[model samples]
Target: MTARALQRMIHVGCRELGLDADTRRDLQLVATGKASMAEMSEAELAKLLEALKARGFKPGFKPGVEPGAKGRRPAAPRPDLRYIHVLWGLLGKAGALKKPGRDGLNAFLRTRFEGKWGSVPIDIDALRDAGQINDVTRALKDMCRRAGVDT
Candidate 1:
């Protein structure tokens, strides 16, 4: 995580734990040997966050989890489409994909396998053939692996 993000999480943790400013500073000094967030390094901020978590501060949804409504879970993707999106999202998070949404993924599939598939649709979910679906999945997995994004 970036230094700024880690610092934000630390602050959030402090708030969730109802720590006063003085106590927060004390915790920071004890955990990282730094009293000011601005003066702390990313590693220090992470350490402070871990310490706060040990104190019972819970963070909300973490990075890379699929987004949904405020209190509702998102519908599950089809089995064939699941890994494709998961890999694509991982690549996106790693800053490897120019267009990270469904449209971009569909475009990528069309560009990469149009000739082999005879005709690739704009919506990848439209794919019906098992071979075509597997091809798209494999291609996406290859891209993710090449980009050093774990599937």
Candidate 2:
């Protein structure tokens, strides 16, 4: 990571850990022997991030993806459909899927559904048959399992 990105992550960590100004300064001093981020090198910033993570500061979002952008949750309303989305996300994260998100999943579903049922739903939510839904879920779960990704 760049120095700027590391510094940004450290600041985000401070907010996530709920550290007050004084406590943050103290921690910085302890970790890098410096109180200001500007004075610390990139390595020092990473060390501080590790300390913050050890103190239970989990990062909430990825660097490029903004908040409320496409994520694990798709627009499908049903719980079972959402579970399919979650499995798709796991495959995407594992780099098993060539494309990710609703469009990719939709395209894959179209091919599979049309081949078996001779027609495809307009979207995942349009899949009304319970058997079809179960088939898609089983397919996604099998893909995840094959990719070494937990469902």
Candidate 3:
């Protein structure tokens, strides 16, 4: 995971634990090897998480798990048509795609999923019927990350 993601997890854990500033600082020092949580290596971040968990600070969600979707089971590992639509909307809002229609989406997909583009239709209905939704979802997420917008 990225350092920023690790830091976010740590902050969320601290908040849930109701840790005071001083205690938080000490934990940060122990976990990150610095007073601040900035620029921590992956190993250090793992250490920090372990320390916090040992201190009874259970994070609301595990690392790599997206937040929200309360009271529902975690989403399936495979991407479905509905998930593709959700990702499409998110990418559009993030300004990663130029326009909002099939043409614009297809253009974006062409750049990322070159090999699969010829088979995948631009029309959402056609794409769904083709059963290439998983590939599209994966490409959309990759594009979002490359565009520096969290998926």
Compare the candidates by TM-score and give the number of the best one.
Answer: 2
TM-score of 2: 0.51
TM values, all candidates: 0.49, 0.51, 0.38
Model 3 agreement with the true structure over 1-151: per-residue lDDT tens digits: 7778878887888877788778888987866667766656777887888888998776766544556645443443445655766777777887777786556766666665657555545545445434466667777788778878676
> What would the per-residue lDDT of candidate 1 be over residues 1-151, giving only the tens digit for each residue?
9998888788777776789899999999999998999998888888899899898776885433544536433533577876677878888899998999777888888788988878887776667788888887888788888998777
Q: What residue runs in model 1 are displaced by over 4 Å at the alpha carbon?
A: 1-77
Give the CA lDDT, 0 to 100, for residue 102 in model 1.
76
lDDT of 2 by residue, 9-114 (tens): 8888887677888999999999889999899888899999998989977787654577778755546778888788888888999999888878898999998778
C-alpha-based local distance difference test score of model 2: 0.85
lDDT of 1 at 27: 95
- Global lDDT scores for all candidate models: 0.80, 0.85, 0.69
Error of 2 at 149 (Å): 0.8
* Residue ranges of candidate 3 with Cα displaced over 4 Å: 61-151
Error of 1 at 49 (Å): 40
- Report how far residue 42 has shifted in candidate 2, in Å: 46
Which stretch of 10 consecutive residues in model 2 shows the poorest summed lDDT?
Answer: 66-75
Deviation (Å) of 15 in candidate 3: 0.5
